[model samples]
Target: MSGFGNGRDIISYVALGDSFTEGMNDPYAESTGTGQERYRGWADRLAEHLARTCGEVRYANLAVRGKLIREIVQRQVPRAVELAPDLVTLCAGGNDIIRPGGDPDATARIFEAAVRRLAATGSRIVVFTGMDTGFQPVMRHLRGKIATYNMHLRAVADEHGCDVVDLWSMRVLQDRRAWSGDRLHLSAEGHRRIALRVCELLDACPPADWRDPWPAEEPLPWRAARQDDLHWAREFLVPWIGRRLTGRSSGDGRTAKRPELERLEPARYRN
Candidate 1:
């Protein structure tokens, strides 16, 4: 256990990273909106759980979609330090690692600097490992790179006394249903599961178990699987590639959803 929620009061919390931490593809129940309003990923879910347990928690999420590790460290890390929160979660570097010619070692060095800086603030820090991409189609080829990065992350956590949410080992996320239509971002259910996992790590009472088995489903036929892949390539992969080639990011004009640490009104956010 990280001793996060173990009798200690977390008055303020900040999350920093990329789309994963930004809560992409997981929209709020009542809103089918776009941009900041539409996404409510795991970090938001974790914040809600914390508010329920600790009360009047100040929360800020400084994660934007399509950000790389250097961008996060250079931009969000300073803002987080200024906030001086009691708890912080950092989940960056996936975008960097997945890109062509991306170096895990170089990324780790940058990541370590950020972690070291945040650790200096005496906040309880949580870092996430990249999920095993072995279950993914084209992404499976990068499994070794991701694994190398995960190892580096574990070392960083050990060195900094940070708690790690080991996504690679979380078998629940291996299911195809856990991912969104793009197969890049997580589904709403996936975000929920992550929240439960974080709650467990922090020793807070999760509404349900993260390990609860998903309902069984029949396998897709071979032709259907191929069709789905083709659709994904057309709808998601190609555009993503074009963006990279043209130096246009999905988050080019976007800012963090919750940029400042503000008191969370449970009634306003809770489901």
Candidate 2:
């Protein structure tokens, strides 16, 4: 458990999900571009745990904010296949359920296709999580659709022999303190809780051998925080307009245009 990553010379993880996985408004978002991760969301926190306790693991977040299952299959999932990650985490089907005038069954079909494609990889350890939608709005109709889609995800995990983390069922989601203003994304502590849970599970059924607790001098030392990694949400990871963007409106009429990033203090950039 302590020297887990050291066991594998190289370990990689790719995250595929909607906004929550992308870490829409998490106060502690890592600056992937020029900023520091600072143990922000689940992706960064999980990476840090592997680095500090287990050893080191290369991680990527291909999750988009407003991405539907169809978009993920077309855009993100392919690159994940190309990366051939040791572990892949899929947190999808949320947006598809809430899209403007969406068709839930169609989105589920796309999700099934994506999971099937990933299953073909025969990955040793694949993990998936359900969407988080437990809040005041309750989002009656969309929540129902999400339940249906998560059911499919469970089926995919069973068929492919992968692990599915029922994130929606986590206590953090059930607790009001863990969510932000909109009651959608997780707070800093919330994200940390998620990372801990995932780590516990990985440690339990670890795919590769644990890294050496005491290894010789490492090739690349973990670098200090970079200023470039600290920027306003838009500037942090925002690709060129021509590149690609998440956090798009799903047209569900529930998509708010206000900057939830406002909740995140720009002063953290003072760090």
Candidate 3:
């Protein structure tokens, strides 16, 4: 396991979790060998960083959108263990915690269990806290649950000797621009910031600081605000609710985009 400032070489890395780790909503066009396109999320960004510093690195991403903590633990964790990567990042439970009747404590327990299993493989494990969502008008109700879950996550990481990317404490992510129009996943910019933070956390490379504040934006007119909300509800919220009701998932029938260990691509950071 590599520690911060240890200057160790990371030859193999794997990412496991849900939409956030899957790089959802941060769309990109890539040749996945089936004429398929995909998003290059923080995991890919970090892999690029590692490759830059270490010459070459092997990487894999097993994340899929809409997976709950249990699903990820059951399906992805074992695969990650089989890979036995030198580095692994796990971020799950967000989809479960945001549900209407979800239990933060119960979810955290399962999350801790997943972490323990991954830690047992002796890979350097990195976990993340959900960003504070209190500022989002529609998602404000989830703030308490996120906070509680974060507490458990921190305690659990400490117990298992894992590194953490504490997104809950990141004030910059509270900005409205950091999120996508769905108010669920991060925007492209948000994913970039997360990649930079992960690089800083791992001491892989000195990328731009993730703490920089976003420039101010003029407030939208009352009419515009109403229209935006209506659009969001119709386009995103309603479908999410329908899926929940039907016991369906956004990740249903979806497989990992980058499932095997491969050489990292060049840095694609765009300032």
Candidate 4:
């Protein structure tokens, strides 16, 4: 708001990160879309909220799936600085922190450096801490590392006077339904909740409450849960490991979906 040279209006915004920001697994309602329009994650949802609230908002998302923190810093951060938008939201380093022998300290150093660069532009910067992974079977063991990195992240935000979206404390995300089938990226409901949370951090009136309670449902039987886990490992986890072994990324040869900031049109906003 203040950084936008206007009172309570973010005229322009740029998003930087990985699959989360890119809107993976959150496809458009009309069709299983392709290319730039395929996903509409939290950043896009936040932009929609801004357009509805602030009027004529310009938004850009320079995020790709499977991108590491270093890649984001090397590729997206410089471009974002050049754009010099009124606001920037970054949520990188998750890919790095989840890898084999990943060091949260090293990741935080790179993350902080990126934050410093963005802070210099006088734009309102918002950074996200990793979510509580204790609910995730595959990622639960790395909770300590994520928590360590989050501490450093908070310190970095404090040092730079940036707002922080502390996702670790977002109890809504711990719900199993908040995640996608692959169990890495968030589900559509998850993205919606995150968008609302980000809007709160930005001091904007979100379209709805992020704290809305999920409907109660019966838990899956023991055998069903085990079968689901096995299926997940076969379909998602194995392919992911294969990619790592072959040095391939889901984002290979991919570029930013919205590389340049553009006006957010009401007609383009999807539910």
Candidate 5:
């Protein structure tokens, strides 16, 4: 049993995405995973929630800020497969529209590839967040791109049997107050809303059971997404707050061994 002591086997979940998934600039995790810094973002909340259900679980935020779809397919996806996680959640594709310019075709292809690889794991459950509603809501072009990417992502997820959070659709009702000053990154409340939805999604559809370990596959190129740290939040609030909140200091103590992502490999598309 884990120190939390719910007396259940620990389930492992691997997150693959951009800054959002990594909890950047979210002012959430004051304690980093390795205990070097604070990781006061949605991932920590998700982990704390997992502890209550599964009791003890390992959740890896393999997401690098500013990550593009191609880099994810080649690197993060591969690493996630290596971990053989029970469930995988993705909150990527936004950077593909904003950073280094948007490449719709390339973004879609790589995102599709990443999903394919993750699905190959067979018994794994995948939760996907769309590519919209971040950055420069004024930039009609980027906003349009986000819409397009989300549509494409939906088709692919449906084809592969993956569940989606539809954050773009869910948060459309909230205004600038929910958005950070940059007009792109999410405000503290926005992130908490997203995190709560994730918990619901996970609980609504549990991961499928697996009998044997997943087989390994060829590695793809990995590109580390670049992102501005959005973790500096003056306000910290967990809405409808869960009963089992990981004590900030205690959780910090547990993450002492985590490693910060320094760099990611660049990758090109397959077609």
Candidate 6:
């Protein structure tokens, strides 16, 4: 209400962005092969944490997987502003900069514009830079670009008086366990860690630690690792490339799962 990180209550919160914001990769019951699972990503988990701290809170998630920054600004930002929530978290531009020929600075510019607009509403804004992809096999080449984008993100957040989640600096995410099979979206455990991180930023409740150490790793056999890579390429990478070439998106016609700001409840998804 008064300002973020000052122990002030956040009554309403809205999330906007791409797949990361959309809560992909976190498993849920209703996901029946269409990939539009109501996976409770960090945003939802953060909302639940907020609800626990504030007794009740109104929340909405306008994030849809596979959306670029421009699409988010054109679509989700206005709706979030209309809702006029006390808190808004923006995590986008990953989809745009992930592609082979994408421009990081341009994407950051577009993203900053959206942040400026959202900040105009007097809502406490939360923004995130993309994680370091150097540890991921297929995404390592994008480390530089993602880093550039992260720098831009921090600058924009400073300019707008917005809080930053700072995903880039989260060394725990460098671990493979934080990623899903696609090596992009965060896994369930990963989402939990991120939820805790975002909650720390919001100063919501007892801050959950995201830096918990993972158990000792047993290295996979070379042959099994090769097989896993092949499977990933065939199932995830191929389809992703096909979508890009065909100019299609996973969220083409899909709308936000929780479009309207409403009271948070236990297990909202029926499926």
User: How well does model 6 score by local distance difference test?
Assistant: 0.84
- TM for candidate 5 is 0.65
Every candidate's CA RMSD: 1.9, 13.6, 2.1, 2.2, 16.2, 2.9
lDDT of 2 by residue, 81-126 (tens): 8777777777776655665566666766777788788867754444
Runs of candidate 2 with Cα error greater than 4 angstroms are: 1-7, 29-39, 124-135, 204-271
Structural similarity to truth (TM-score) of each candidate: 0.94, 0.66, 0.93, 0.94, 0.65, 0.92
Lowest summed lDDT across 10 adjacent residues in model 3 is found at 1-10
The per-prediction tally of clashing pairs is: 0, 15, 0, 0, 27, 0
TM-score (C-alpha) between model 4 and the true structure: 0.94
Residue-level lDDT of model 3, residues 110-208, one tens digit each, is 998898888889899999998888788777899999999999999999999989999988888888788899988888889989998988888766568
Q: How far is candidate 6 from the true structure (C-alpha RMSD, Å)?
A: 2.9
**Residue-level lDDT tens digits of model 6 in 1-271:** 3434343444889999888887888866666676645678888888876776574589999999889889999999999989989889998899889887999999989998999899889988989878887778788899899998888988998899988888888999888889899886899889989988877766664355788888899989999999999999999999999999998998888888789999986356321
Sorted on TM-score, highest at the top, how do the candidates line up? 1, 4, 3, 6, 2, 5
Give every collision pair in model 6. Answer: none
Q: For model 5, how does the per-residue alpha-carbon lDDT over 1-271 read when each residue is reduced to its tens digit? A: 0122234465666777766766655664334465344444565456555655554476677766555566666667778777777677776666566544577667887788778878888635555545344443334556667677778888888888887777766643245445665544566655655666666666622222212223454543343111222222222222102212431211221221223322111121000
Between candidates 3 and 5, the TM-score winner: 3
